[model samples]
Target chain A: MNRRDLALGKLRGLGNSIIDDVENNMVPSIKVPSRGTSNIVYDEAKRYYVLGDRYGKRSLGNVKQIKKVAQMVSMGNFCKGLVNTEKTATIREMYYVSEGWDVDFSNQDESNLIVEDLEVTMGISREDLGLMPEEDGASVYGDLTLKDDDVEINAIKSGKSGYSISPTIDEIEFLDHGVERVIAVETMGMFHRMVQEKAYKKFNCLIVGLKGQAARATRRFIKRTHDELGLPVYICNDGDPWGFHIAMVIMSGSAKLAHVNHELATPDAKFLGVTASDIINYDLPTDNLKDIDVLRLKELSKDPRYRDEFWQNEIKKMLKIGKKAEQQSFSKYGLEYVVEKYLPEKLDAM
Target chain B: MNRRDLALGKLRGLGNSIIDDVENNMVPSIKVPSRGTSNIVYDEAKRYYVLGDRYGKRSLGNVKQIKKVAQMVSMGNFCKGLVNTEKTATIREMYYVSEGWDVDFSNQDESNLIVEDLEVTMGISREDLGLMPEEDGASVYGDLTLKDDDVEINAIKSGKSGYSISPTIDEIEFLDHGVERVIAVETMGMFHRMVQEKAYKKFNCLIVGLKGQAARATRRFIKRTHDELGLPVYICNDGDPWGFHIAMVIMSGSAKLAHVNHELATPDAKFLGVTASDIINYDLPTDNLKDIDVLRLKELSKDPRYRDEFWQNEIKKMLKIGKKAEQQSFSKYGLEYVVEKYLPEKLDAM
Candidate 1:
């Protein structure tokens, strides 16, 4: 069966199971895998976070659980309808859609949780259930060709701005490309610089602009490019703890959404910096580390995802230097400096 | 001469005039049109804000003005190099690039002011000077065809996600499309819904997602679509002062960016909204107006942009209702209800 059909079956099965419980005069209950940090396990083998054996149950019998149970059932019905109709709604739309339900969500956050609950219980990604994110993924450029349905989009030929990654990335197939590696830059300015200078052609790679902490679709796209297309991924970001965390989120899965890490996390991705060391070596224009930066650096230093000697040393070095720099700081050399000198040097070392 | 040549000539001319002054042992100076609110005027003919007759001067002789004069000259030289090399830099990149110069910018805001200074003095858009904003423009999905250099992109055919507006919008030419009108949406959720439902095909119109306050390129794209392609423009946003203000920014122009309003504003664009009447007539799910929302409504009521009877009534009604609703609030009917019902009603009324 297709992914959509599989998702439909699971949603329907959940609804049927609840109906069966009602017919049998037993309390209908939904078992959701606990997504709390305590139940979140760092899977060393897969190099991503996963839910542990712990599970939570919401039942119709208890007043405390009744509302949640109704919400779960309503969401299941909604997902089934979406898959059946071949229509999709963003998580926000789903919240608004719930207003018509007898058991409606109090807010978007409550509805968002139910969607997560459905995902965990059904063992299906939200995309398969015909739900998408509101924000777009990322901007991509270079020689890569992506096929979505019958339409084929050659990123380089699309336009000077290239292609915006679809929110529902699962539907897109990496058709063909001459690129050997993927270099994801954090800032749009640096990304545009690379595109303008045709850094992809010079380095034989595709450039993905992460546009800040990447949306789930952006991470999925990067993961797919690395695994399905066999392109080694390298991330270039500002020399700061926040940048490191963003890179870490893509490398491992984000702790907040660890349930979908298998599809989103790219463990093999390498970090190409604006590293703390690079800030010192290149003599880039620097900003004094703010209090928040220091706090975040301390926090990441303890994070399991950034526990490696290299990351540990870098974090320490950054704390010692008491400064941070953006990727565009290389523009001090010239506009072409990042693509021509800094990038080539980093990639050569890799 | 072309725009690039025209811009280069202006920059060089300014430089030469300064050189001539210096050769004659006179202090070098540059006159910049004041961009403060007091120096801002509403042009009734153009229906957008324009700079007034007030001017500010920075000369090399005064110790207080030396830093700014040196910075302005350095920026002119930098812009000349960019034009000569056929390169582009973001306002942020220009600040970082300043690090290599004898007269470096202390902060990004200060550098941004210098770019504006050059723009005001030379009467040239920053795009002509090869300076671009870092933010990507809004996403567009429709039958519209855009020609960016040799690449021709049919928005509808691009992918389900559609096309991202290029930051440098001047280079893109609106080719052709089978669309009668353009609808710019404030939220991505509603935008995605319209795209998913093939609302463009159904209504015979193009849909542009503002993704919040419309970016300069997005506004420019909408303006081009309406003026060049003869498509009427309509804006759909939440029933709030902020949303109304965003619509105003697209239609009449933003006061903060008054200098570029000629290129960015669409005076003929109509507001098709989740207005106060719609909130009551449709009985949409709503949130009580926050203190800031009320304050904004009161402030907008006093502004000349919202001086029309329609806007005044809407603003007064919104304050009276003491509540606001999002575009997604229409999803209370169903997922497809927005594209199938609300939009058709609004478009018909227009």
Candidate 2:
């Protein structure tokens, strides 16, 4: 895709709110979510995508199991063939994001649509959502920096009761202070676990939620809290594609932050989770690993700047085994197994 | 994928002393085949991507269908359960794309490789070459229009030998005479159809090759020929991903042209053959489409410019009777069908 194509592709799914997010500079950098309610949720729902996520209640490599659970939840085959008592579920791409076509919606229900018209069902018509070249240079925020500490000051009350969390820089200034590791979790439920879960207590962590106005507000609070506290946050998310992408949002921010040099929420945050590699690390079943997940693991390994010693080591491990581990597999291991076999070994290694 | 990663992704197979036609200067464009007969054939064989022709062969859409045929050939999945064929042959992706352990030997084997990794393939590890992001911004000569006349130059010398067709602009030489719509086919088989098959008698066009070195040489000759004899060249190839990409490469020259905007190719070329939409339109067997194909179709239709009147009207004809038509399906109509439903009916509508 050329620069123009990239720009148009990025411009897709700019709902009034998302467009405003770009205009107002909320996330600083924004990308088409590979996870978390992407546009595919609406249009591609019927197609039954091979979902992958990196989110969950446990930071115990939950970021690595997103694809495993997503495959179970999103694929048509998984719906009928899946094991009845397993913790995993498959989800179609549309379940999490809107890819623009109402895959399940036939033109019969609406007069404006024609079932046979490829453009209509695919949202490719001239007036409607046609395939635009992907947007490349467009910014998520006017000038938000993924690596910058100076977040823009704008308070808008939203959601039920019109509530907003306006934690001033001064109020959250403690986040910028002395700290060793500031790990961030996307769910309060996970937060509850880290503070309470025996496996996660070894490291200093922060947990936050990703849904609703309250969740956004909490995310803002967490960002400020981490910044002021000077904590190096590690993100722990669900073990699915959606969860994996959500953590990335908190980590690198997005392309819009090309201007910012600081205000990074998690500049060095890594994919700390129950990765595919763990499947072999611990004796777990590997049936749920999809080609895409395997593909993603290889891709992450190939990335130059995105490469890290930890990932390099993990890639070496996968190469040795030719397999990956799913975090959902651990759910079967039981909470006791997680605490005993998984966490202690994992924390010590990290 | 980062810059370096993208550079590596495209260099999958580059060898031989053939100069990089797309890039103006010598870059890591071609890998010299090994020093054996097979090696020389393999090295030189890179050029015969598709067969070549001198005038209208098949269209890009048709070329795509051929590519799918190649993919099926490589995988040995063709006619798995086809009528009259009960024997099954399973194929793997690695066969055609040669990936080595923790890495692809084929990718490693190629030399003078100009293009490298892609952003789409970056998520995988090198050990298995499982999945990774395909490299995105490795600059190449063609992909999109960086130079208008470069496309023309390419058109002229596309099928020639012992010459490289580099787009050059002079004071008042070439512009004095603008060209008209002239079709350029990419295969000798397609060329056979024109002369022996009398395919050209049906339309005003040119011919190139459909395979290897001869095809590349034909393209060079086409571009250079057009320069010596200015003629607006329209392309007709297959419609599958590879075919679409080939057309794109010919149109843009390569991403390497990003540096010099003057000699870039043009984008006015038209697609005339089987397309992803045909799966929906012709009601043809869709099992041939890949998982990503559906998503891509959704993306293509969403482009704003595609929604415009001229393009939309042309695309809309596929639904003339609220039904889509596949080029392959036209075969069912047979040679008689070619005279009846195709040609006059099809081209007239277009």
Candidate 2: give its CA RMSD in angstroms.
Answer: 27.5
Per-model TM against the reference: 0.98, 0.25
Model 1's chain B yields a TM-score of: 0.96
Residues B95-178, candidate 1: write the lDDT tens digits: 988988888878899999988888888888898898999998988888988888788899987777788888878878878788
RMSD of 1: 1.5
Residue A244 CA displacement from its true place in model 1, Å: 0.3
lDDT of 1 by residue, A77-135 (tens): 88888888878888888898888889998888889888888889988888888888888
Error of 1 at A25 (Å): 5.0
Could you say which candidate leads in TM-score? Answer: 1
The segments of candidate 2 whose C-alpha lies over 4 angstroms from its true place after superposition are A1-181, A186-205, A209-226, A238-249, A285-287, A313-328, B1-350
Give the CAPRI rating of model 1.
high
Each model's iRMS = 1.1, 28.0
